[model samples]
Target: MFEHIDFNNLLATYGYLAVFIGCLLEGETILILGGVAAHQQALHLPLVIFWASLGGMLGDQALFWIGRYFGARLLPRLHRQQAAIERVTGLIHRHPLTSIFSVRFLYGMRLVGPMVIGASRLSPLRFSLMNLLGALVWAALFASAGYWAGQFLESLLGDLKPYRLPIAVGVVIVVGGIALARHLRAKAKEQHKA
Candidate 1:
């Protein structure tokens, strides 16, 4: 089943969609992969960044509205995230603008930060503006990092065409493993807190 599909062609055609969708949820890995693809000329760097930023901003905006309209009802259902919610809430209170702009850069806070702010008394316009700025900066930074890594790997390998597939697979496996480990650790911590 996998052999019939050309991975490179698929990425070239649908890379932006992948980046957009991936960034809509948890996105670092996807954006990095896209950046690597761009470095390999499988995708355009600027378009990748644009789609990623849009997706990131839209995702946060949706979560913000959800929190604004349904936070009270949503809170009890998010018992596992109670600690995170509280922390973000406090940050928003103390430093509303900074917190809004910096949350994307902070680990474990990406999803919850905007929600917490929306649930607060912060203005919608303010959140939107800051969210856009943050998303763009975050997208550029991560994507560039991935591109740089690809460049370094290419230089180290001396020639990448012969090993591109294997190298891509290896990178994916390593990143996936790391993400899974982090997720498990976070879950364990949440359970311990509970």
Candidate 2:
């Protein structure tokens, strides 16, 4: 699996498309990592940002409609994850804007937040505007972080170009896996603690 996906080459060759797909899958980490790749000259910055933001908008837009259309019906089906569902519902009830945008920063929330909003009675137009703004800001932040990280790393190591791909993949896999594990572990702990 790892051998097949060449991060640097892929992002460099297919920045926007890759970003779009990443966003569609709610792969914010990959999107942000692509930004870092952009800094490496392996990818184009503007293209990365454009695709990522577009993907985010489309993904969230779809979710909003899902909520608007099937929210009530789906609520019962979400019995196992009722707490999370309710949290999102509360988010929609209380701070809809924060629910729409800030969820992008959260791994699990990214997927559920939009769906919850879609499930709620929030206005589609309002959701669209918030989703777009959030997606753009999120894309800019991650892309910039990725690009600058590349530059900073290059300067720090004095010659990261040679080991760039290996280093990048290593970092991506390690950090991403760690974060995921931590999230899962925390969730598990919460369940047990609760």
Candidate 3:
């Protein structure tokens, strides 16, 4: 499967939908990587941004509507993870609209925020408008950042095609290790609270 779908082909085929699902599922790193691929000419920048922003907007809109219709039941169904629920609740309590846009940076809340807002009785039209704006901003930031970063990396790795896999693997391993550590720490905190 991996060999069948190379990066360029994958982006060309599913880049738009990937952005949508990424936003719906709160997959930022994946989305950013898409932007990196776009920078590599595997995808078109405007189309990438358009699709990403659209996906994000639609995902939030769907979640918001679900929240509006489902109300309190939405929270219990959407986020079973206690810590995430608590964090989102705290954010919503402290800063309604700000939390809506800002939480895009947070993996857990990126998808869940719209639902929570919907449950909280936020107006749908207003939320949709803001959500679209947020999606545009978020997609642009990550895509541009990833594109530039990939460019810098490419420059640094000039004529080093053979080392690409090793370097990529090393970076993934290091980042994955850090993520695992954070997950463990968060789990420990949750256990302590329990």
Candidate 4:
């Protein structure tokens, strides 16, 4: 059923939107795909980065707003992430700017860290500014990784025309599997904690 899909055309049309939405959650995988699309000339690298930055910044902002406005009511529900919350709290206390700037890069803390920061006493304007910078860096870094990866593959395999489908499928499956595994693990951990 999927054989007739023109990846290049599809990506060219919706790749930026995908990158934007994908950056909202587990974006690394999708952003990488965008980068690959850019390498394929199916998408533009700068636009890919732009959309990623916008989406990432807005997503974190929304989370931050939630934490700021509803943290008192919401935090208790996240007992499973207590350790992560505490770590983020400690970072905020010690280095507010650094914490806000680097939270997205920290392993396993990407989603929760912004919310934690939101719950803190840090200024919203400050958080917004820093979050923007962080998003830009994160987007550029990951998207570039994808772009270079395509280049590396091309150098090794000559032409990528024959391998696009397998590569795309493999990336999606691997990313999905990883996301599902993490979700299940976290769910089990929450249950165990309860």
Number of the top lDDT candidate = 4
* Candidates sorted by lDDT, best first: 4, 1, 2, 3
Residues 68-164, model 4: lDDT tens digits:
9888788778876887788899999999999999998876688888888998958999999999999999999999988997898889987876677
**Candidate 1 lDDT by residue in tens digits, 106-193:** 7778887787888895899999999999999999998998788889988898655556667668767988898689788888987887
Using TM-score as the measure, what is the rank order of every candidate, best first?
Answer: 4, 1, 2, 3
RMSD of 2: 3.0
Lowest lDDT 10-residue stretch of candidate 2: 1-10
lDDT of 2 by residue, 1-194 (tens): 46566656665677677779888777566776777677776778888888898998898888778767887887678665566677777776788888887777765677667878877777788888888999999998888877887787878776655666676677678768987897888678668967
Which pairs in model 1 have colliding backbones? none
The lDDT values for all models are: 0.85, 0.77, 0.70, 0.87
Better of 2 and 3 by TM-score: 2
TM-score per candidate, in order? 0.88, 0.84, 0.78, 0.88
Considering summed lDDT, which 10 consecutive residues are worst modelled in model 3?
A: 159-168
| Clashes per candidate (backbone, < 3 Å) | 0, 5, 0, 0
Over 1-194, each residue of candidate 3 has an lDDT whose tens digit, in order, gives: 34443555656788777766776666455556666666667677777778778877787788888878885865786434656767877887888777677767675466566767887886677777778788889888877876776677779876433443454465457657866887788878878977
Candidate 3 — which residues are off by over 4 angstroms?
1-10, 77-79, 159-179
- TM match of model 4 to true structure: 0.88
Residue 44 deviation, candidate 2, in Å? 2.3
Model 4, position 173, has a per-residue lDDT of 93
